[model samples]
Target: MLKGKRILVAGAGGLLGCKLCADVLSAGALVVAADINLAAMDERLQQHGIASDDARVARVSLDLSDSSSVEQFFCSLTDLDGAVNCTYPRNKRYGAKFQDVTLADFNENVSLHLGSSFLFMQQCAKYFISNQRPFSLVNISSIYGVVAPKFEIYENTPMTMPVEYAAIKSALLHLSKYVASFMSDSRFRSNCVSPGGIKDGQPEEFLQNYRSYCLGKGMLDISDVVGSIIFLLSDHARYINGQNIVIDDGFIL
Candidate 1:
């Protein structure tokens, strides 16, 4: 559906971001994978049978915390048909317990990621408007944004859902919705995708505990969310705007 489309994937070095980039490339789209550093591992990309130097993929440097960097990245590009923000900005206090959550870390993290998303949207709007091109923007949110964290699942585990994430992600949905509605052209749409817990390198006990809470898919692979993202970015979903497509396996229920 996205053949020849040029997609900019922010936070492209991370696990979920890399998977999305790979999928986009497989669909015959050009990928401008940007992150704080172009640290996407060759082994990781090749794990999916995609080579690191594939002609379709271009790696760029980006830092979400800096507005100048965000603006510079967008200004440097003229071929972006769509952009996706899959950034999960964190620091020392990210996974801290709810009680231990501090205002400083929360605000800092939110400001950086949210600021990046904002600048991305602004530049995207400018680019689309000035170029008279139809464009799409996708913000990666979490199922926790839809519903509160089920504290019970983390019991006996060292995990506690970051309070800052909840605040930031929920705000992201509203931001996307506003942009979708706020835009003049329906073609320049903004939407969000909220996925459930993606299986990473969590402890075995934590994994077991987490798996028991799901309805169908016990835990998500990074690839699970790619379809939803591709759909939203492609022209096939032109009718979809100002919407939040949740990819959780009833975990939020």
Candidate 2:
């Protein structure tokens, strides 16, 4: 239960990010939803039926790749108790072998998945350290970062298998650990959540294949991952830090 806490969620327009924001708000937390596309955020908020006067929810237009913008955003916040890094690049039209991966594709994924997360965490850490406040950061990663899938799931969809995504996610986990270690004496904490395959209107054939494969292995939906995030961000996980919790229904097993 995060009541009266100030929480910032980057990439708040995405499916998971939207769910997280709504849940956090329902839990009585003040949420700052930051996204590159304000229109998308507006649409999402409207769909959620959140009114303009809802002081508990604020939509901010943020370009995470821009360092000055990120700094300004964080500086504007009065009390940042927690942050969730869920920003991801458009995964459409970009699946290929490592050798076939283009520089642009690689850079785009890296900038969003890795660069943005690093910048946000760095800013949050500085603020928390200087203000002597106990804060937590939950970074969203993928199960693929830990275990390579036999088949490329993002191929047919706008999503793709890029070396940069995997590399950056792996790096994010380590970065969380490093931040945790550096602030071991402080109240600042950082951790990662690696979710498994998320089903969201994929082709029926593809969905069947994915479900069968994952069933043979083990996979779960987006809801399965929310609990871990809630725990990591809540006071319940105050002592937990520098850890990567995988919630993939034993797919990695």
Q: Write the per-residue lDDT of candidate 2 for residues 94-155, one digit (tens) a residue.
A: 55678887888877777766887889889989888777778989998888778776565444
Question: Which candidate number has the best TM-score?
Answer: 1
1-253: candidate 1 lDDT, tens digit per residue: 8997999988887788889888998787998888775645445557766677788888787887777777777778887889898777778667888788788987887887777678777878877877777788888999988999888778788888888888888888998887877786887989999998888877777777777888866679887899999999999998788899998888877
| Residue pairs with backbone atoms closer than 3 Å in model 1 (clashes) | none
Candidate 2 C-alpha RMSD relative to the actual structure: 2.6
The 0-to-1 C-alpha lDDT of every candidate, in the order given, reads: 0.82, 0.79
What's the lDDT of the predicted structure labeled candidate 1?
0.82
TM-score of 2: 0.89
**How many residue pairs clash in all the candidates, one count each?**
0, 3
**Which ten residues in a row are the worst by lDDT in model 1?**
37-46
Off by over 4 Å in 2: 90-93, 152-160, 215-219
